[model samples]
Target: MELAKMTPLAGLVALLALAGPGAAETFTLRIGSGHAVGPVTYVNTSRDFLVPEIEKRVAERTEHKVRLIEAYGGSLAKLDETLEAVEKGILDMGHVCFCFEPSKAMVQNLNYFIPFSPPSAVQQLAITRKVYDQNPALSEHFSTNYNQTLLALSGYDNYNVGTKFEWEKFADLSGHKLGGAGPNLVWLEGSGTTVVQTGIPDYYTNIQTGVIEGNMLFPSSYFGLKLYEVAPNYKIIDMGAMMVNGLLINNDTLAKLPPEVTDIIREVAREYEQVTAEALDRDQAAGIEKLKAAGAVITVLSPEERQAWAERLAGLPGAKAKEFTEAGFDGPAIFRSYLDAAKEAGYSFPVAYAIE
Candidate 1:
């Protein structure tokens, strides 16, 4: 009886040895965003595109699997705190909006400071990707200073003004307090308009309470936030599409991932950028239609007036370049490269910014 029991135990041990390396390891990734899930929003892209693609690709191409733990709508980190949270490893990944931390992300905010480039969402996305891929300094800044790796970049459609009053000419904005985020606020520097320095979340309350006469934002945000109910006038300024935010992974978490899994994440991130740009294009058109249906008056400034606005802000880009150069970045080279890319992409600016 003892010999028979010993033989079965030896057979069981042999069988266990043949089972290859146990099951594949499952790595859990926590992706956090301040934005909530809504139709035609970046959060939708994260939920419907980035997460699923990463999961599918990892399963198909690697022995490891990824389990995405999503924490959106400020459940993990608010918009402004996302970069810090990821750096501190509180979240594995996050969407960091450069607009929120302009001073720290000066290089990434290049698009915001240089207006009258490409207003097409696709072109803007392509230009930013191209610039970032070619410039090692920009990438180094993220990894060295922030303890994060940038996977992809995304942006909104061209900015427009939504106001309680109509805007026909530059002079029409005189004495009006308009709310805008940093850097873009400088676009109104000499237009006789007062900058409220507010963000999108506060636009509705500010406009409704007469604290601000209007807010500068894209059509998708204006429509999604239902700002037309209070600020019912829309002016299409076409102030160039901006690279607003990026998908970033904590460096420590990225270092822990398998090589194959890391490759898939990078591949899917490029696709995510394309999908986001396409979504912005679609949503802006839909948003415009919705705003019109909701009794929002829509108007486009004439070419002459648009050029005048561009000239008014022409000093901004060079000033920004000087500021960056003083801070040890090759700002003029980056600025020139961007303009060259925009030109190659078929964009003709109304006013040429003197970067040199």
Candidate 2:
């Protein structure tokens, strides 16, 4: 039988039941993630915080028969390989950061390059979930290509202008040396700003040595990476929210699980998704405060400045959609569906670009 032809939900239940409840029998699953356990005084909170939570839930719900062995902090796999790793069962499940593979994961990063009206974490999460739920084709694309299931979708905090140079408009970026991830390179175009491809880990020193003038990143991540001390200016671009991470599981692994065990996993994922969202919301506000206390200047783009930047990239939306469709997916339609659903859910982008 074709794997795609078989629906996922029921298959999962039978597999778990077959594993049986014999006291002597133990089933082990290895899940991979990309953050390490750190000291109590760490700059960024690790996935270490989530490990115990998952273990507790699994033990309580599965009679302690299933063990989720974890590979943390890219020890088992790195971000770019995670999607394929999970699908090929190189690891049962893993953390997939789309930003690392934006070219291949266009649909996943559609919003990463766009600007948000409020640029609030809570609003971004709400809109993301609604957009994900409303677009099955977008959801299924993952299943079809990676042979994995997207357990949950979440967004990171908004990107702030972290730089040695202060910026309030797109033009201010001109002649500036900047480092950025994902599609942020587009922002440097026509502005004379030179784009440096520095990974997040190198952002701090790169700025300090004059290797780059500034970089764009989420405040939480900037704090996590300690870029504030070197650059010391946190400018709110309001361009868009950043999506740093998500989790995916091998479909074959998921299909092999007993329905009850699968149910437990799904429930735990949903719970953690909410926990993550709330934490991100709080962390975003907290990060800004922490950076401000540390002497970082925060710049909020005025309405006129925001519009000017938006105008410079006037047809960016169409170009993005077309790029996706040209890649053999319904990129334009997928993009439209997300926006329409967001509007339906009461999210109105101040400047609505008519997507083809």
lDDT of candidate 1 at residue 173, scale 0 to 100: 94
Score candidate 2 by TM-score against the native.
Answer: 0.84
Report the Cα lDDT for residue 197, model 2. 69
> Residue-pair clashes per candidate, as listed?
0, 7
Give TM-scores for every candidate, taking all chains together and pairing residue i with residue i: 0.92, 0.84
Minimal lDDT window, size 10, model 2:
37-46
Among all candidates shown, the one with the greatest lDDT: 1
RMSD of 1: 3.0
> What C-alpha lDDT do the candidate models reach, one value each?
0.85, 0.69
Tens digits of per-residue lDDT, candidate 2, 184-235, equal: 6776567888898666656778888999987877777777767777887777
**Candidate 1 wrong stretches, greater than 4 Å:** 1-23
- The list of candidate 2 runs beyond 4 A from truth reads 1-25, 35-50
